[model samples]
Target: MPPQRPAPSARFTPPSRVRAAAFGLLGTVALVAFGLRIGDVAFVDEYAYISQSYYADLFLTGEWNDPAWLDFPGYDLMPLPKYLIGTALRVSNEPRPGPAAARMWYANTHSTFGTPRTLTSARVPSILVGGLGCLALAAIGAMAFDFRVGIAAGVLLMLNPLYALHAHRAMSEAPCEAFLMASLALALAAWRRSFAGRASGFRILGLLAGAGVAAALAVLAKFNGLLALMTIAAWAGLAWAIPRGAGWGWLWFATGSALAAVTAGLAFMALNPYMTARDPVYRVADPADAGPLRPGPLGAWGRFRLLIDHRRAMSAGQQRIFPHNALKRLPERAKVVAVQGFGRFGPFGPATSDSTIRYDMRQDRGAFAWLPLCLGAMGYAMAYGRMQSRRREPPAAWAVAAWALVSLTVVTLYLPMAWDRYLLPIQAPFSLLAAAAIVGAWDALARLAGWKPRLEPS
Candidate 1:
């Protein structure tokens, strides 16, 4: 009889040093999340959070009843982050009254840097959420690929100064990315379970529901999180295409998709009462009346329309101010995005601005050029592997490739300016790929050098 193969546990496992390295990396990510470059400078957009959060607290939680609550949040397509900003400012308020409530004070006019109390109120949530996002990214890397890959991705993202810059701001990008990564991690887990042949009805549905809910929250945070739709669609598509038991494939997929949609839809409607409004309601700032709000009844469709109209209006205003920003060349935009993907910007050609984040166009950059090198190595490995194996890799491999490359391409096609922060979503997935590439290159070099890898001996 043929010798029985060793059990799975007896085969391969990471060494203690790898575990130690991962923990160390995680510790470093946690440490840097709070202070590095945080409160460096006051951004022009920071003032909106002051007034918006004030109105949010007065309307969302306080007994104060006014139609202005609907209008105070923001003009952007999304509304959930207002609640987070509101809660942060409330914490600042409880610690004794001060200039934290002065709405116009933070408009990049009075101060060059963020003040103590206001910075805490406005940016703490983002800092914590962004730190947690690094954790989720690690999990995504592990689930989608391996533990080493996850750890590397997390470290790379943590080291990315651009991510650090925006993460410390009261912007929608960080939270949106966190939720989007969470959804991807959940979907990956579900895929692994199904691949292992243990996909029970309850297990699959629970995972799908969780993923869907995360996606909904992501979109609520930022329309950029709408990328979650691709993930959800991929799962639903897989359900229909990938074979289940003999004759139940169609029914199983249909049930899961419908159930997940229903559950997530309910959660979304609950989280964003903006969807429940009967007509279109939007906020307009009035310096004379200190930003009075006017809201109309709005339904779900109206909310979506609000997003489109607001984006269009923003585009028009931006074009007037930065006329050269609307570069119509796809190749030029793509080149700019690719460069920013690795945490470098300025186009700095020298880091300046007192090492503080003053302008989105120019700041700390050219730091992670090595990342793209790793990406190139990783791409070579992937291509070589594909050539050697006739079979395709998992669905995630294709999805991630599209996410990193295609998504960047799409974003660039419409990108109005060379803003580095807007590249966060694209950089996120690309970071994962680049981390894998780095590991692959190191292994390749080690092999070439005749260095043996550590293995558990029986």
Candidate 2:
């Protein structure tokens, strides 16, 4: 050097320091995850699940008939996850005398474990699953951006009250989220590697298997899980459509999709004995069972009568009354019931003293508002677009964004009931995108300013 510049001193933080920082960040995320679930009420459908665990045992052991077990229709709605939970209980030291035995044992053991047994015990799986969801989001972010983005995404997910509230509950939403997140992570990684021309056959197979398992698990968790699979299929199709890699990529994707469907079907049949029946007795009844239904005052009463009659007949196994005419009225009657039920109890305005209705409405409206989420989404889109235009986008960024968007759209649009629980699956990703937006915008603004970049000696 002409000026004999002084030797540059090493100013970089040591690898050990970096590792320590990461550990500290993870610890903070863990704290957030733990704190958010504290003091949450088992308010919405919590009892229904608790009751299902109790009754599932009864049905399995032949103590309860199909009709008795079917009284709570939600049990039949998603059978695999609940059944798996029940199986876990049986395998444990918990009593197996009958359907009620698990509940009894749970009651005695819950407090000892530092959580209430009823909803808490049932929620154990969900909590673990939610934690996994956080991890998946972090992986997605890291793979899509950098370690910093991953850690921030994980922290945001842990701190997000929407995710935490549902995670703490004994519901299927958390599990569904876990499966969906995991599937997306793996699929994105596989896609990235495939695009980079580094994916081996084994890697592709492993990724496909993981995706299949995750998608099947999601289906088992909730009917909405099917949306995840659909998203994957679309993503894979599009990825293959681009003249990028070997033709084998499309074959691999198709195989994975078929395997997922088969796994899901098998899991459903194995868990739900009812599916095997050629002619299941309790098929969703036709609208004609209710009679000729009109929307006016007299017609409404006629529809109500038809509904009552149908219920009575189903309960007593009698011939369906008003079969033909009632069928036409059923749709109108259902609409009326849904509207009345929601208006009377839904949280469109202020909270009420009626505990059940108040809680139900609050939970529904709180889940549906999406105001905070929408803000975060806007932030993510801006950041994502900028990264793409700048040619600084990570390999998996598009995949993760697509996956999140598809999952959110499916749940918000396809599902009939938009309960707060339905929003749980998207919460983790939403938090990630929100954090990315904030950090990316801040960095962009800093760059726009006259701030000089400094590089520490490595």
Candidate 3:
């Protein structure tokens, strides 16, 4: 018996018109999804992100109108979005100085029953960035699988209850993952073009450069943005190990990682002055209690280690405070992953428990639950099957499987508690796979009816 060579996936590529229609529909969904949620203030974490971005600006510029502005309660994550979100709020005329900003935060969150202009402005960046994420996911689906999968996945992501409620908040989820998705999308497209001999060496190198920059920006957006690099690196490492018909060597994947590392290092220093800015001896609270704490500029390597340390401290604190939320055991972790990723009830409020589940369903639950997950399973099965077969398959198809699996496994294993938004790492890939399932069914129905749209190859 001879080994079976897998069929190339370029045959599945939809024509220009179908591709355009898919993108157009996805764009509309992404925009509408973002527009509806830009005004939301239901999530409490929103308070910190806007305030931190505000404080980051003040600290960097040395523009302290009030002494209180020096108390820049820094973010536990990366530094890029501080500038991005701050710039947005500033352009929208967010209240400046320490007290007014504090008052605004307090008014909108704790005491006041009214929505503020600043809250909406603070969230605009998230909404815009999240919208980009939706479109990017759709692109990943179309390029990796089919237009049906791509469109369905994008719509599901845009409208998912957990994604809608948190992904567009003035926080870390959307900005980081969107850029990561872009990097993966670029990698998929480049891999296909290179395999087909449609791209020159220079063009291929350019694509790699773009993917690297996007990956770098993703990391700067958030630390977990490493998922993008990790996915590419994994596929690169595995691609060589697997017996295949034809594809680029794993060295290109190595180049991507190197490029991302270099770009992140350069961009970190360039975009965030805080990396080199001096920190004055400032006490956390009362000047009398404890001593003044000081640290030098968090240079390239230091920042990543510092982030890890901060997260470790956070985990320790969480264990003590939120005793019931720890995922120390396998079953415990599995249950949380299922709830946060597939099920409805999840960690909300200032705490990581659903007891504070005043989070309204009509406002938040915009996506289907069991159906998408089931479809994603079927879709992912097909992708994995293609990769396993001896025949040629799109790198993006295999890469999506790798991305989702790695991310989901990491989340399942490493996530300290059951926070819904932590599922951001795995959501994009899953959504695309779910779309694949739907597309499979649609195509079957079209074939049966003898009126399937003519899907010519590119």
Candidate 4:
């Protein structure tokens, strides 16, 4: 070695390592913020918690087959959240009053509701899941783009008022977001591994299977779980189509995807027996009770059929809240999406204003709204520019853009009612996109200023 090449700066730290540290700190801050007042009494949507009590009581009594439990509104629509609550209650040996001769006696008798006196058991899972969502966002960003992008995305997500507020609440959205992001990240990672020349069959299978399980858990958390499958499919489709010629890799990926689907089905049925099992032994409601109840010695498929019908009815009923014409509704929907994405602009912003004065005042002025908006637009533009210039775009960008576009389109078309909470699925992708923008903009600025970048582009 040339003696003049004196010890190339051993003290210089890798940019990736620096970014990882920043991300870890951001995640920690998010965890603490989410955990704050987790067990505090919920003022709004208390009914959701109360509804969970019914399912928990049934599970505690070993009476999951009871059709009577199906009487609750939206019961057939989603059952995974409550099933999870039951598991948590049983494992912790919380004070469940069900299975006692009188149902709802202990719950109604005590103001705190049945099972755990503190709301900790009910709320902790959501808080933990919310924290996991933040990390998953980072992983997706890092794996798809770079470590710096991941860290920036995570910090932005934590700073989001709507996301942060809902994270600690005993609600399904937080957990849904967590499962959704985890599934997407795992699926993307699996595909990347498979594309590598040295990828092992076992490794690919494991990644695919893990993704399937996460997908199932996501669905259990909320009906929107199905969207994860769609996102992964779009990613795979884009990957295959963008390349010049079909390769053996496509066949392998498709086979793995089929296996993942089967695994997802098994996981879904295992966690939620009511969707498949015909065991009338646990009489959730009397079989004789009339109305739309279908008579049965039902098949495994019967529950799903009933669920479909119920969802259809619910959807039709919800149309009253939205404009009859989709065209007329598009502007309002777009406004909501923009406000939610970039954040509220000023004091008493329309998007941030709410019934709760304190909450409204705090959220009306969003944190670094313009910066994220500017960076995100630039990032996407750069991505497209690269593709146009004959550079193979990063697969992660395609995956994230597809997720955001598909999710936005579906919600705008099918979801008649407009509520901010309904848009939770977009949070991760939005944060990631913004982070991409920031990083992309920084690189452009560096190039313009003729400064050397420490970390080369991945």
Candidate 5:
């Protein structure tokens, strides 16, 4: 008889059913929470996007080459989310008049939060996208570590007030967060596949391409999302070329990444006609509602010109806000992250709720706030330090380090705002890193306290 195969090791193997159930539960929680008071407020920003969607409908109905009729001055607005909302409106057979259709589109889905009941439908897209963002967080964590870490990260992100607030609103941030995490997950997979072997050529190419596509969508959702793309490039660099590593594998990854970048550029152009259309109109006001419609030059170069013009407009807009000293602002930024993003303790005083929501932070000592943060710090330190000594370090570990580093640098150094919404991208990654530290500490403790049993005669 053939020798019995050695018992399968269960130490590192995770339960699939449990992971699925956790993900499902997390998704449900996200949907419910996001949907609860989503239409509570009709923010000024929402109107901008709704108007853009109306413009999209008109553009879609007009000539392909001369989208001259589709000039909405906020043409500088991110395209994917607006395009998606417009597509949804079209599918629902919204009427022709933009404002009338906009008003009628989100008619009758409201809870008691003082916003217009008709605006409820407008928030639906955000609700759905936000729920999906939770799942994306889970997927990213799991790809980097294990199922438990992923679930923990997802659940923590779901419960966080800052993420939830932006997610529930009909804004660009939710979609941007979702797409950013999706791209990060795909980038991780691409790195894994690219290094596995030449046998994974097609798989590697697909992953890289997918990452590129997702990154493009993220950027189209918000120009700030270019940070995720930068992170991806940085991670690839760290994985290859660094630590005395280089070969055909590195070449393949570089080639795939270059192609992926080109793909992303093409995707951006394809999605945003304002970026490529000739003689496109840049309307600041709805034509039906006493217009600010202005006709611009035509073609691809025209698109670039429009973008530059928009940038100047944005720069002018930014000038109105008072600037804060960066050094003095660091503490304020920390307080926001600790209280709103991470929820270190009871939500009051400095350790308090976010700008939009008044959520009670973790009251218990063992709650997600402190323990996970401490552990995450440990995990980060361990990963960063251990790699120097180890000849062959795990890619996942390094990726996590790189993610935290890149995200932290970008968030703290470049971005002047301390809003929790802007900090959403780092939440899931931090929680996962925390979970890693917790598990690592637990295992170390177990080994220290474990007992050995002597086998007599097997």
Candidate 6:
């Protein structure tokens, strides 16, 4: 006899309830993990933002910017949070508001706390975002495959100390990643509904709008978000092309996508006024500085140059270049002098650890722990083959696979500089793929071993 199947009611239990419970547990775990890092207070970028907050206040109070603050060339990449914190401090008007307020406030109040803001508060946003990101990953997995996959992905993400470390710091990466995952999840959900022939016009519009807002926020959080947007767009186009007929679905998809693009563009324009005022000559030097760069065509070269220029401009303000005379013998020293680029060479040899766990502990590390990742990659290949053979894959799965591949290729080819934080945003999807492979491999092994399958009442 064929294997007995579970009851319909068993499969019909509300997925939303399961997701909420899983998210609650994941959030609790993340909070506990973050609390352990609460004493860490050595972030390098904290002081810089504090200074920016003070200047922003000066601009607000009419003490600076005789020209309108909007006209100033300053690039305050930080969005509402930074300014809101500063405004809060100004409103409190405490004689000595404290470091938290000082960092958030317009004035220097570091001395009052006798310490900087506790790591907990400084890192609260990261922790929250990271936790949400984990939940989002789980949701994506559940939507794509099943609850098992979602739970497994969420657990893996929660345990990944590299993510945990970043989440406990006052950085934008965690939040950006969270938004990216959330946007992707929403898009996938909508796509699934559309595929099932249940999509309403308003629902589709809302998905696109949410995606646009998320993508824009991701860009505002960090420039890497453009990669996420491009990935989604390519997936959408492929979906449109492969369908049997050019129906109203494609029309709705196109309209929604166009609106999303417009929204992202407007957000970029609103936040990056510098793009408008920037001299064309200065902007032309680096292709990465213009907008987003994709790998496909030579046309992307212009955008790559703009990206490079943006990096150069930002790094110039952050780093102090050594005099060329100090490195007379180095062959490429002239290039460094000309472009003000600094090279980092280490005597300790190459970093080769998986995840940022070791890096957070001040140890040398690489992108991820190599062995598990390699195994995971192999597993993904197997899963891909299985899905192809069975024809059971969802459209979003293909999109995610393509996104991961393209993003990885671009980052590897164009930006060889490996920073642990750079990998955070992609970690969610990567982890899910990895987990899928692992689960698939285990199932295969169980079958090979002739293990009896668990039976559920019909």
Name the runs in model 1 displaced over 4 angstroms. Answer: 1-12, 15-28, 55-65, 72-74, 92-115, 235-264, 277-295, 339-396, 454-458
The whole-model C-alpha lDDT of candidate 3 against the native structure comes to: 0.62
TM-score of each: 0.77, 0.62, 0.80, 0.78, 0.75, 0.67
Q: Residue by residue across 1-458, what tens digits does model 4's lDDT show?
A: 21121122211134666766776787788889888757655634533454454565565566656655445332443655665555555667665333331223223434345533435666666777778888988888777666777777887777676677668776677878888889888888876654443345566667778888898888877777878887877766865665532234544556667667778878877766565434455444444332344324555466656666676675665555444422236766665555533454221234333522222325434535643574465468446434522433234566677777778676665544445566666666767777777777787797899986674434
Q: What lDDT tens digits, residue by residue, belong to model 1 across residues 1-458?
A: 32223222211237769766776669466547655656566665655554455445544664233444354343443656666776777766633222233333434334322346666567777787778778888877665555677787887777665666667787777788888888777766665454333346567668768877987888778777767656556565654564333334334444565665676677776676555543333446455433234345565666558666777677667767666555456776666565554435321223222313322344335534544564674575355334322232233444455456545655786776656556667767777877767676676798899995664422
**Candidates 3 and 4: which is better by lDDT?**
3
Error of 6 at 441 (Å): 2.4
Best-matching candidate per TM-score: 3
Top-down lDDT ranking: 3, 4, 5, 1, 2, 6
lDDT of 6 by residue, 365-395 (tens): 2223433463465457545534532442334
Instruction: Write candidate 5's Cα lDDT for 284-306 as tens digits.
Output: 54445322354455566566566
Q: Show pairs that collide, candidate 4.
A: 66-282, 66-283, 66-284, 67-283, 67-284, 67-285, 68-284, 68-285, 375-437
- Model 2 per-residue lDDT tens digits across residues 135-219: 7777777666555567778776666655666566666777777787788778767665554333364676578667767876786
Q: How many collisions per candidate? A: 5, 10, 5, 9, 7, 20
Query: lDDT of model 1 at residue 10?
Result: 14
RMSD of candidates 1 onward, in order: 5.7, 12.0, 5.4, 6.7, 7.1, 10.0
Better of 3 and 6 by TM-score: 3
- Two-way TM-score contest, 1 vs 3, winner: 3
How much RMSD separates candidate 4 from the native structure? 6.7
The lDDT, on a scale of 0 to 1, for candidate 4 is: 0.61
* TM-score of candidate 3 versus the correct structure, residues matched by position: 0.80
lDDT of each: 0.59, 0.52, 0.62, 0.61, 0.61, 0.52
